[model samples]
Target: MSEFDAIVVGAGPAGSSAAIRMANKKLNVLLVERADPPGSKNVSGGILWGNALAEIIPEWEKDIPLERLITHKGTTFLTKDSSISIDFRSTKFLENHSGYSVLRARMDNALANSARKAGAMVVTGVTVDRVAKEEGKVVGVEQDGEIITSDAVILAEGANPRVAIDSGLRKPIGDQDVAIGVKQIIRLPENTINERFNLKGSEGFAGEYVLSYLEGEAEAGGFLYTNKDTISIGAVISSSKLREDGQTHSYDIMESFVQHPHIAPLLEGGKLEEYSAHLVCEGGIDSVPRIYGDGYLIAGDAAGFSFSNGLMIQGMNYAITSGIAAADTVIEAKERGNFSSDSLASYERKLEDSYVLKDLKNFRNIDKVTWSRVTHRAIPKIAENLLYSMYHETGRPKKHLMQMILESSRDSGMSKSQLILESYRMMRRM
Candidate 1:
């Protein structure tokens, strides 16, 4: 007999959140995960954006096992021997408490427990081989040669989703559609981290980076996040770019980034804690596949709800919102006794009406700026050269800032016109 009223695949932030929402509505939901526990396999440079989590767990910031609340955030450009950063700070940082730095295993497990408390079954180490379809509609999922049936199945499978692809609900994830992220948790004293990052007490820091030292062929960028007693540092490169360049692997990039002259000093006494590698959504809106199909819907990374708009990597918030939306759609579908594609299409409408799709649509052209060869490769070096030249002093006559910019552009093989044009295009589109 079909036991669960609904089945949710992959018990990460998306799946667990969806399960909690549905179970809270008195629907019997089963959340399946392949990891030994809920978040053992998930990885991210993850700083969970707030406000959405409040919908699921109001005052979540007060009680969750949050590593740190972001009080300072910025971007940096890394060179071989030095680095420069642009900082954004305000007295309002303490008031707003923007986001939280999290390790997936810790955060996801906490959320999963909340889901279980809300009356959802969270099963771990269960591999969902495929979503079962009957007469051209999803009915359940197949696990270990057994058919586990349910009225609705929400696929919250992470990036590079296999369940959606197998059921033809979505296409294969292109390498260009995804990026590879490698992160290492470096352990340090809480006080040491605060002093180094110029944060006081428990205030945390988050940052993005454009690495000029990676030799440019990798088409990658970097991010650093401060946690309670550790810092997460890593790089994210285009998946296809990595395959084609054959330049360096994730391991190599992590080592190089930590050992860089500027980064090394900050991490001087830190001990290695944990290392994790994973894939992240790089495709923005264009990569989103069919979100709703017969008796099934997709949310979170599986639906490509994640978006990186150059300046920030945003996923957890989108995942939380989309997961809630997916559950809400199923709630209405059950009320109407309809599980067809037409009914489930409401999920897409719900997301479109919300910030998830709105932001994706709003920043649709971001990849044109972030992933472009000129933007990733030349811009960082140009900024580095210009800053170094403008600041470095010697006996010779110093050049003006304009001259420094021109020289840097020439050194980076970028013309003034091209730079101006690209900057203008980014402004118009982004």
Candidate 2:
């Protein structure tokens, strides 16, 4: 008999959730993490959206170390000297509590501990070399020099899925299929944060910006999230765009972002406390690989469950959803006494039935629109010029909105046809 019924790789949200679920069902589970503490190696923009966590721990909000509740969300298009933004604030966000800003190191560690409390044998500081297999069926994981055997293996090893790739469950991700994100934790007094962000108590603001100031071929966006006594700010850029630009470094982009006139004032008195960088999967649904095979299933970034639809980026919720689905699939397989490829395929069906796969599939082409010049350059320039012309009154006659639109489109170097085409693309994709 196998030592454990299932071995979960990685202890981030997905692995921990899966381990917790299976353990709660009274299955023997081993949860492994390469990092000494579960969330030490993880990085994100600091917002966990949706109600997926409640499925794992019903009163998670009461227990998790959340930074702030996200009551406002904004997106801005930026030029060198101006910006156009759409800001939305809702009391309903506070009433229903759909999202929260979180520090990964603290939140993920607590989640892993929850798995332990649910009876999972949590092991940290252990690297899983690859999934151990015999007769082309995954049996467990290989760590150090030993084979820790189990009836099944679940890969939750974040974006750099070494074990999944090595096991031939998926091919190497292409440069176009991924993104690189760099984040900074800036410390400010709680009162200072509340004042600067116009927030009260634990209410927070989350903003994403379309970056148009980069000096190369790079396509990227910047984000800022309000935390308890700190701010989480970062940029996520297309990996292929970064390579093609060759001249821009990720740090340089970050420096430029922080110093922007519109951004600088909000963080004037903050001190940099931490900096981290990591790879993020942003290829939408097309880049996702087969999630399940014989006696094995992949969850979280390992299965490319992340989604970015230009306006917002979502991954954590999808990670939790996929994790729960993977565990449920295992539970069903166990009842049937079968850990075969066909049996594990139910995981995919479960995802399809949930918002995880449905949202990804519906917005599959959004990444293309986000990476287009219309989003990064043309739109920002047009908005800046139009708004500046309208508000920056001269003694001369003021033009009507339609005439201003025409002039702005021409000034932005986009013809009528190109503008119409781009608008169509956005409509179709979004």
Candidate 3:
């Protein structure tokens, strides 16, 4: 019989952000989390980019406990025996409010604590079984047969959006629109990490790899990031594609990535400390669900708000921004004493006006390009072969770059015209 102004489900970035904003407005807000602690069940590759942190918590660099700030970025394409890498570094990224690398367990715990300090009531170790509805209007949430009434509910339940789907607010997401990401934290000496990635002081390096050597068999990509005294490494594969493959599991894909000649040396003496797996909403704008319902709103992965447009994987920023927008809508509803779908519809408008929806809408075709067999299998191989031919030195005669390109294209089984068209499409979409 407990009553509150609003109930926010899941204490990840989105939920905490919403709760913090609500509490700051003197609204009675409750943040319900299923984990024993705020981030106990959360796992991420852990990169916070853009100006999201500043918007949520100003002076965050000085006030928050973070692993490191990122100043080095690298992307590598791997063949069985060779690798090609591109790296970039900037002094601008070393400033006080720059991007950061963090462990979600620690970071989310801090975010939850901030919400509590802002006057939001946070309850952990409880799962919201369902949204309580009256005459098709969400009035509260049910947990362990107990009913807690609230004026509105915000669903930020991460990738597994059971509550949102169950509430009839969103259609069940298909596996084709999702990805399974498996990651591990491996302990390495701080000196070793610095030397391995060429980092100075607390600056960190992040590397993304596409395993072209695996050829037609590799249906996914890999990533490596340098943490304080540990390295984060992982692979993400289309869930439906992975299931279709049948013989490979996340562990196998991870092993293949680590054993790649270009990647093995950096992981030579590292000790594995943790392993985790989670689903990523990679559906782009096409997969985003309806934002508002009779008395509920969806944010974060629950609403398919993730964007993976090749160069970057962004979800946390989108989640945080959407959560703030949803909170603003709830605040407005409170003032008007109207929690109808019409009033909550403002959340959708805010999202559409912001970069969250704009970026996703702009790159709507990216998901299709990424999931294409040609991009996932053929393009990388062609690039690797082209690079190999261009770099290899022969005593007798050398082929021109154009000749190497033709040969590599022939080897990839695609005609020059097809390659040109696909490349053009990808460039436009990206």
TM-score top scorer: 2
TM-score of 2: 0.98
Q: Model 3: runs farther than 4 Å from truth? A: 96-98, 215-218, 309-311
User: On residues 244-301, what C-alpha lDDT tens digit does candidate 1 reach at each position?
Assistant: 7786786787778888887889888899888888888878898999898888989899
Kindly give the stretch of ten consecutive residues in candidate 3 with the minimal lDDT sum: 210-219
**Which is better, 2 or 3, measured by TM-score?**
2
RMSD of 2: 1.0
lDDT, residue 196, candidate 1: 95
Candidate with more favorable, higher TM-score: 1 or 2: 2
Candidates sorted by TM-score, best first: 2, 1, 3
Off-target runs (Cα >4 Å) in candidate 2 are 309-311
Residue range 31-100, candidate 2, lDDT tens digits: 9999989899899897999888888799999878999999999999878888789999999997898889
Candidate 1 residue pairs in backbone clash: none
Quote the positional error of residue 400 for candidate 1 in Å: 3.8
RMSD of 3: 1.8
What tens digits encode model 3's per-residue C-alpha lDDT throughout 144-233?
A: 778899999999999888888776778888975688888999999999999988888899987777655553343677778888999988
Off by over 4 Å in 1: 309-311, 396-398
At residue 231, what lDDT does model 3 achieve?
A: 91
